[model samples]
Target: MGLLVVKNIGLLLTMSNRLAIADAVVVIKDGVIEWVGPSAEFDLDLYQDCTVIDADGGLVTPGLVECHTHLIFAGGRSDEFEARATGVPYAEIARRGGGIAKTVKATREASEDQLFELAVPRVYSFLAQGVTTVEAKSGYGLDFDSEMRLLNVAARLDKATPVDIVSTFLGAHSIPAEAKENRAAFVDDICDRWIPEVAQRQLAVFCDVFCESIAFSVDESRRILKAGLLAGLKPKIHAEQLARTGGALLAAELGAVSADHLDFASKQDAKALAEAGTVGVLLPGCAVSMCKPDFPDPKLLQAAGVKIALSTDYNPGSSVTLNLPLMGSFAMAFMGMSAMEVWEAITINAAAALDLQDFVGMVKPGYKGDLVIFRGADPVGPFYEYGGSKVAKVIKEGSVVVRRDPCGGVTI
Candidate 1:
């Protein structure tokens, strides 16, 4: 194998605190980082045919990872957006035939091919912002065939795009209107019919339930998640979003990999998450869009020794934005996280939520060479820039998949 050298790095934000910044050159070979040391120590003659990428004193960091997203769905919620802007309450709209149900209707009506074609541009939107990996969930389809259609489309979209997409089966996101009176039956369908088929086909990697007041109760959520585990899918849950129903506690009890949307989580929930080793995935975008008074207190969670991760929670109804840099900035400004802390949350911690931390989160020897270069010296500026800066370049598996600004822009 040959080496590819990235030299003249302005600053390297390695995940290690001691080795956080290095005025060094990184040597990559066959899609893995081979060596990282001061530029002067480089033996340029060792690899004659290796590709050379000059960093030009720019920031080099591991590619951004969107730990949670709803990037696989059809139809837009622009009507809901307009309604919300007019000072209409979100609950009011939901009561009047809107919200996730509207999306469910739209999604169920769309064909699998239609869903995949619609999702391609959105996936690129994430990649354009330097996000190389995203964990997407299929929750809009609350029924058997529609849910399977959503997941299959998501799988196909993953193959079509450059981004690594990990799908989560969220059959319990909500009970469709048809199942509104038969909630228990809907849960049964999710556990018996949906989980078995999806798990048997390996259509998704994780199983998620929206454990909310209007969705599944704590007991129902536990039952569905347990079934998913039996079917060989890892557990994740939407907990404490609108209100504190002990959903976080349930997630901790079940040893879920991650518990998301802790808008109303308490100090006790934080402690349980810490003890259970469940990562907390916070979505400020949803909070911002819904104008919900509750937002997760990251400081309390960190104090409890719980790991934190940030995500877009990108969806048509609640949050329509795919700009993770903006989410990072919002994570800091609104969620009360530091710039460095938010960066770590979005990269390493986010990767951990998807169980990909070891391979793709940080830059190190033997780690996958998934890299992103930013024009500014700091990753924080992308958030602070309010989406002004472009991703200079992106590399996946040691291949330059995206590079532009031949001088400083991203090209793919």
Candidate 2:
């Protein structure tokens, strides 16, 4: 975490107001970016003790940020994938106890150590794909004990891995079967008991709810979010994924940081989000995984001047991939977003969704020295290339964490 230098950058995307520089160089000191400018102006005689990283004319950008992910789940849902491939709707499968409930059951049965072990490899997967920071939610455990277990595992993950894990409380993900008879009491438990405990323990920075017909009603979501807000946690919501149930409007009303999975959000919802400065996180992976033709319209959000961000929404039931670039590809191909917009969505815009824009998103002076070096010079290569990782090296806080060799060998 001492002096570090990255030179020979063929193309550098600062992501600060979408600035791009050619033949750039970045200098870091004590895990903070000290200077970033053209290599020609860099004083080679100074800082000879610094560890130099030759970019080899690669494209360098800020480390990718995954703003929405359920990264602490215990089980997989491959069977649901097969069922959906056979034309069964996701909601119908969920109604039959095959969606988040199935994963919740498995997660509740898992020990904290087991969940941590299972999540380490997933964190490495994101690191290899150039994701340096991830917003991991705790929702696979609906009960208080199980939910605490998930958040504990996420905290452990942040220490155990190089990738920064931002924990979010999502106890309102779904209603457990045991609480189905008395949903009001379950909501009360979340509002009165779980939210307070989580806030007191500093277990999460944000409180999130899945506000849909399949999950909590708009009023219930508001109650949960307000409880969290009063407890000093910011608000985020899973809105309009399966249907338009007034969740987006509620998120805007509550001034949530982000409203995600807006597949059914209308233009008015877009306007509300814009006025409220809430990021609209589009999860294209969910649409592709569920075989649903509907996706969040980037055009509509853009027209309304709403900031849009894209995420993998890495979870067991619906989206399972950790490839952020693949999600960017899906955004451009199906959602009518350009390559520049896709880049911004996963970097600066995504950091905004997590309320970390001031610290990590852009490659500028005073920002953390987290960056990704892609193999090619073209800034759009990752989105253009569909399969495999285009990342050659990943740096976290001025230290080399991941390096991929020419023969597909990875060094961590």
Q: Residue 355: error of model 1 in Å?
A: 1.1
lDDT of each: 0.84, 0.93
User: What would the per-residue lDDT of candidate 2 be over residues 292-374, giving only the tens digit for each residue?
Assistant: 78777888888999888999999987888989999998998898899889999999999999999999889999999999999
lDDT of 1: 0.84
Residue 362 Cα positional deviation in candidate 2, in Å, after optimal superposition: 0.4
Tell me the lDDT of model 1 at 147.
88
lDDT of 1 at 261: 86
- On the 0 to 100 scale, the lDDT of residue 43 in model 1 is 82
Best by lDDT: 2
TM-score of each: 0.95, 0.98
| Best by the TM-score measure | 2
Per-residue CA lDDT of candidate 1, range 8-95, in tens? 8877776645255556677789988878777778887886888888877778888889988887777777877777778898788988
